[model samples]
Target chain A: MRIVRTVADLRAALAGARAGRIGFVPTMGALHEGHLSLLRAARAENETIVLSIFVNPTQFDEAADLTAYPRTEDRDVELAASAGVDVVFAPDASEMYPAGFATTVSVSGRIAETLEGAHRGRAHFDGVATVVVKLLLAVLPDTAYFGAKDAQQVVVVRRAVADLGIAAKIAVRPTSRDDDGLARSSRNARLSPDERRRAAAIPRALGAIRDAAAAGETDAAALRARGLDVLAGAGIDPEYLAVVDPDTLEPMQVVDRRALVAVAARAGPTRLIDNVEIDPETGR
Target chain B: MRIVRTVADLRAALAGARAGRIGFVPTMGALHEGHLSLLRAARAENETIVLSIFVNPTQFDEAADLTAYPRTEDRDVELAASAGVDVVFAPDASEMYPAGFATTVSVSGRIAETLEGAHRGRAHFDGVATVVVKLLLAVLPDTAYFGAKDAQQVVVVRRAVADLGIAAKIAVRPTSRDDDGLARSSRNARLSPDERRRAAAIPRALGAIRDAAAAGETDAAALRARGLDVLAGAGIDPEYLAVVDPDTLEPMQVVDRRALVAVAARAGPTRLIDNVEIDPETGR
Candidate 1:
């Protein structure tokens, strides 16, 4: 695998990659199974696979969280290589933001205002959208792989790619999970050992919401209440637990069709979010 | 020249155009000498030239201005073909925005605030940046030509392209003007014959500011005062008259090295904007 640290080098590598189908996976490096899953998907699907590790400062709503975020580069490169990634792009913040950087790409409206977006503020999504565009343009990937773990992020990115008329396809892989049912995330490692045990409630709460919806309880408020009760029952108070349209992220009053039940909660100084799409008929 | 009205057709045409350097000129399609200048520059510098006429509604703060905007498609195609344009993309607003379009590209901070941006609001710039990105990604041109007549517009678009890490190079052509020296613009057609004659004050004011700065006028306020004086002498009250940093568009306190002297005035219901870059050393 080749490691490129500069934009010029990244583009030079991509110039030769145009003849083949290129698949991309962008991440903040900690090299968890969630990231590996995306890389593996890209590897299986394209003749060329590129993964980028950028601890984008703009996306972090809290400075301490950014500082506390894990950085395991050597292990990450090894993990990427094992996952069959052909090129690993590790760019510093200076290269991405350079001096006089004043433009930002934003996805607004309902999708930008609920759940995690409401808690973290629009800057988080702005950071995500901007960096994603830069990465997509840098590689001009034929297909970009994203895990459904960050479901809202997938929605925002899809909106950007489609709205901007970007000439690329977004392939979302299934969310990777731990044996405890906790969604696999870099933040999962941040959980204290005991806190890790409690983290399973986050996904379970979403699962319970799906169960209620599948059982013909389609009231949006009731579905949300059921999910909240699961978290509340576990001595956990979630930031938000709501039912929303899968695409627009607009809160729905009733689950008349497929909807996304998302959850966000804090456990022992770590913030974790997980979501599931609930078909009104099947529930999961 | 072939006229392509759909994004799919445009992309299909561009796919085969990759072997050669493509130059693009995006326009509102009133097709005056101003747009012709950009087309001519693109024609000279590239093997393939793609011109688009999309009077993006999102960019217009006034619905009336959008409605009033001239669009002569048949004549536009004829002019483009005569100027050696290879492809003309004339997409309707629906073709561009469609339904569920929720993403926007914006340039914030000083550049987005002064001049036309400050006068028209950020929505004007937000619309411009969003549509410009869509067009740039649509064609993936080697170079895109823009006229310096809309000087601040040039700055905002350049900032967006650079900040987004878009691959295309931005080439700013010299502003085209009438024999009387009024800047060439589609909006210029909105002026009454008498209003057209008065429009000369716009450029004359900018010229007077440059003359003052060239002749050892180092005070920023004094430079702006002189520019404003010329407009005032013509019985015109400008929306804004100032000397600012060329790149950031921040109002300068003193003409230390170089500054942009800009003005906007309404003459008989038509708004006209003009600017000139003046270096304390060269002044023109």
Candidate 2:
């Protein structure tokens, strides 16, 4: 696979492939099962597959978190190559945001202003939207792959892409998870042995909400309480356990049709989030 | 020229032209000599020319101004055809911004927060940046043309295009002017006969500053005072008379190199703006 480090270089590499279908996967460097899943999905679909590894600094709400975020470039490139990635774009912060970079792409309203937005502050999504737009423009892919692990992020990006009329399709694959149901994430590497065990409660809590919703519990507050109980029993206090509309991310009072139950919590020094979509008629 | 009203149709029309150079000119209807000049420039250089006429409502800070803005589609189509435009994309507000649209493209820092930004509020530039991004993406032109009459706007749009990594070159044509040296603008039609005559003072004010700079006057404050004197002589009170860096839009204490002298004033009920770039060594 060819690895490029500049936007101009990335564009030049993709110029010849414009006539063919191009599938893109944008990720932060430390590749996990979730990222690999996206790459594999992209590989199966397009004539050219481009993988971008940029741990965008603007998206990090805390400096400590940004510093702690892993950067295993060599391993990431190997995994991307294994997944049949044709090109790997690894640009530094300076290349992505050079001197006098002052533009921001933002998606306002509930999709952006709640859940992650409430906890991480608006800058998080603004940063994500900005970098994603830049990457999409840089790649001009026919379709971009994203894992559903960052569910809220998928919604925000979809909103930004649609609102801006970006000519790229966003395809989301299901979240990749471990045997114990802990969502696979690069941050999972930071979890301690005991903390890792406790992190399983997050998925369990989401599962509980799904089970209850499937069994005809329509009240959103009741569904939230059921999940809160599961987390509390596992000795984990969630930052937020919300029952919301899958699209708008607005808090839903009743799960009349479909609802998303999402949870975020601190496991030792690491923060982890998990979510699941549930239907009242049937549980998947 | 064939006029298309939707983004899908616009894209379909320009799909075959992707092999050749596409030059785009984005404007608010009621075409004048200034817009015609940009079209002419595009005609001379590009194989296909796309003109978009959208009076974006989001860019207007005041409802009255938006209501008062001109919309002459028949005349605009005739003028665009005369100027050799191949296709005209004229999407209405609803077409451009359908239901649940929530994205905003903004340029921060001095370039976006001062002068016109301060007078019209930050929403003005935010709206402009957002719509311009949408329009640029829709046309995907090889080069986009803009007039230098709206100097600060040119700066803002340039900043946004560069920051976003948009795949288009911004070509700025010199400001088109009337026989009386007044910058040609669609808004000029709203001016009364007396106000139309008074509007010429705006350009004269910029000329005074340019002339003073050419004569080795380096002090920005002194240069601004010269422009103010000219405006005062015409019995006009300017909203702002600024000598600033052409790129950053920051007030320049000393014009050691390149500087932009810009002025905005009320000519009766109509508000008009004018600017001129000056170099101390050899000012045009």
Candidate 3:
């Protein structure tokens, strides 16, 4: 895979592949199996696969979260090449956002006020939406891929692209998980061995609720209660456990249609999130 | 100029042009000498010149203002063609902003907060920034031209483009004025015969401030007072008269450096704005 470190370099590379379908996966560095899965999916469907590894600082609400985000450039480059990636754009913060960058993209009401958005501090989604739109513009991809791990983010970004009249198809790939069902995440690197062991309980708790709902539960409130009990049993500190409509991310009751049972919890200092769909009548 | 109403038609026309420098000017349909000057400037600098005539509804805060906004499509097309513009895009509101469109581009806490933005109510500049950015993206022009009559808008938009990391170079063309010093504008169409005569005071007011500053009027308050007197003498309803930093649009005292003298007023029911640069030491 070719490695590009500046916007100019990426633009030059992209110019050569103008007519073909370019599948793009934008990322923050510290690639894991999950990111590789996204890349592999892109390579399968596109004539040219372009992956960007930019740890956008604007999206981080906490300064410490920005600093704590892992960096593994040398390892990432090797993994990308091994995965048959055509190009990897790893831009420094300065290149992506110069000294005086000022324009921001914001979606009001619906996407910016539910689930994860409701709990997160101000402008977090705005930062995410703005950076993603910029990346999409820079790439001009025929198809852009986002992981379902950030399902709400995918919906919000899709809305942004559609609302802006950007001519790019968006795909939300399923969340990659481990043997214990834990959702793969870059922040997983922050967990100590003991914390990692406990973190598995997050997915396990979600799985328990999914299995219960799959069996018969239809009441969203009752399902939420079951999920909360599982989290408490696992000794996890729950931030929020919600059953919401998958499309709007607004909390819903009596899951008679497509819905998501999502959860966020802190196991030690590392925060983890996981969710599963509650199928129509069975709620699974 | 060829009048193209659809996005596809506009794109196809632009595609046939040589991949050389293209200059763009976006405007509402009513063409005046001011808009003609911008087209002329673009023709001089660019390999191909393109103009868009879309009366953007999003920018109008008041429905009555929108209804009263003038549109002279036939004259505009003829004027553009005579000025040597290669293509003109005149899209309907529905085509530009289809159903479900909901994204916005924002330049926060910058100079967009005062002057025209404050007087026009919230979401006015938001709409302007969003539409301008979208148009820039669609055309991908080498340079975009805007009139300096909207001095606050010029500064705010420049800031927006810079902040968004948009590469298109923005050039602020000189404000085109009439024989009596009234700024050229599409809204001038709404001015009654008497109101049109009175509207000349807006520019005269600006000119007086410029003259005062050039004559070494160091006090900002005194400069505003004199400028307001000029508007009052012409029987124009003065909304605001102030001296501000040319670049930041921030209110300034003592025009020791390059400053702008800006005014806004109502002649009958039509609001008019005008501005000029001042050199306090010279009082020119």
Candidate 4:
């Protein structure tokens, strides 16, 4: 595996592999099993696997969060290589954005106006859409892998690609989770020992709500209350817990159709989020 | 030259070409000498040349402008073939932009805020940047040619390509002008014979100011007044005549640095615009 730090260098490497099927997985460094899962999936599908590790500053709303985000360049390269990534591109912000950079990509409504969009500050998704467009253009991959852990992000990216006529197949990988049912996240490492232990309840709370919704508990308000109560019982500061349509991302009064039971909470200094689907027919 | 309308057809035709070099010229139909000059330049520089005549509706602010825009597809194909163009793509709006399109590209501040940018209505350049990006991606040309007659348009496009990190060399062809000094434009056809004759003076006025600047005229206000007065003397409704920095597009008060002597006017019912550079030291 080659560790490339410049867009030009990465392009040079990709040029030779143009005829081969390429799969891209873009990530901020501090790779965990979740990111490695995306890479391994890309490796399985594409003849040429390219992973980019750039901690995009534009996506972070809080300065302290941006500064505190983990960086593990050396370990990330080794992990990606072991996961069968063909190339690891680790570009600095300056390389991605030189002087006189002025262009931005934005979507007006719906996709950028709910759930995470509401919580994430202004221009957050604009930055995401712009950087993703840039990376997709640079890589020119046949398929790109993104985990469903960031569910809203996947929807926004898919919408951007489709609306803008960008040619790429986006494969949304299932969210990777730890043995305790906690979602595998880079931020998971930031959780203290007690916080990690308590984080298991986050997913467990979402599971209970999904079970209730499947059992014909059609009241959205009740479902939200139950989920929030679970997080509160776990001594977590519940940010938001809601029942929403999975595809459209609109709030739902009941699980009459496909719905997502999503939750977000602050467990100590680490903010954790998790979700589960409610199967209306199965009542599971 | 083969006229390809669909993206698939264009891709196939481009793929079949020899792997020497490819030059592309994207234009709105009703080709004049200026567009032909670009085609000629492309033919001279590359082993294969592809031209796209897409009068993108998204770029037009006025319905009348779009309606009045010429559509001479058959003649355009013949002219392109004569100019040795390998392929000509003339896609309908539906073929390029389908329903449910939501993404847009916007450049901030100066480049998107001057001359044509200020004159054209909202989302015009967004449409241009988006469509241009799409075309550049689809054609994958080694070199792309654009005329400098639309000076601000050139800067906006150049900034977009650089900001998006698109890997294509952009060549700005010098503006084509008539003997009487009117710049060549498809809209010039909208003018009556007398209006067209009067339009010639638009460029003539700028040339006189350029000559004055060459003779060591330093005050930008004086240069602008001279250009505007010349146009007014010709009975043209001089919209604006100014000496300004070429790159920044900011109004200049002194001609110690590089400047552009540009003019826009209403010749009867038709609007005509023209410009010339003032290089104080070289005295062109």
C-alpha RMSD by candidate, in order = 1.8, 1.1, 2.9, 2.3
Distance from true location, Cα of A129 in model 3, Å: 0.9
| lDDT of each residue in B57-173, candidate 2, tens digit only | 999988988999999999999999989999999998899999999999999999999999999999999999999999999999999999998899989999999999998999999
* Candidate with more favorable, higher TM-score: 2 or 4: 2
Provide the DockQ value for model 4. Answer: 0.68
**Superposed Cα RMSD, model 4:** 2.3
Q: For model 1, how does the per-residue alpha-carbon lDDT over B1-284 read when each residue is reduced to its tens digit?
A: 78899889998988888989999999999899999989888888899999999889999988877888887888898999899998999999998998988899999888888788889988999999999999998888999999887788889999999888888999998889899889898999899888887789888888887778778888887877887787788889999887888887888898987787788889986777877888877656
lDDT of 2 by residue, A1-284 (tens): 89999999998899899889999999997998888888888888899999999999999999999999999999999998899999999999999899999999999998998989999999999999999999999999999999888899999999999999999999999999999899999999999989999999889888888888778889999989898888888899988999888998888998998788888899998999889999876655
* Cα distance off (Å), candidate 4, residue A154: 1.4
lDDT of 1 at A239: 82
| Model 2 RMSD in angstroms | 1.1
C-alpha lDDT values of all predictions:
0.88, 0.92, 0.82, 0.83
Please state the Cα-based DockQ of model 3 relative to the true two-chain complex.
Answer: 0.55
After superposition, the stretches of candidate 4 with alpha carbons farther than 4 Å from their true spots are: A235-238, A279-284
lDDT of 3 at A236: 79
Write candidate 4's Cα lDDT for A1-284 as tens digits: 88888888999988889888999999998998888888888888899999999989888877877888999899988888789888888888998888778898886566677766778764888889999999998888999999888887888899888766667899988889989999988888788889988888888888878877767788889887777777778787677787877767888886777787777787787777777777777776
In terms of lDDT, the best-performing candidate is: 2
Give the Å shift of residue A167 in candidate 4: 2.9
* Model 3: TM-score, first chain: 0.96
Residues B1-284 of candidate 4 have per-residue lDDT tens digits of 68899888988998877477889999998999999999999999999899999999889878887898888888988889999999898888888877656678888877686666666754778888888887887788889999878776777788888888888889989999877667889998898888877787787778778888888888887877777777777777676776768877788888887887766678875666677777887887
Decide which is better by lDDT, 1 or 4. Answer: 1
DockQ of predictions, in order shown: 0.88, 0.95, 0.55, 0.68
- Comparing candidate 1 with candidate 4, which one achieves the higher TM-score? 1
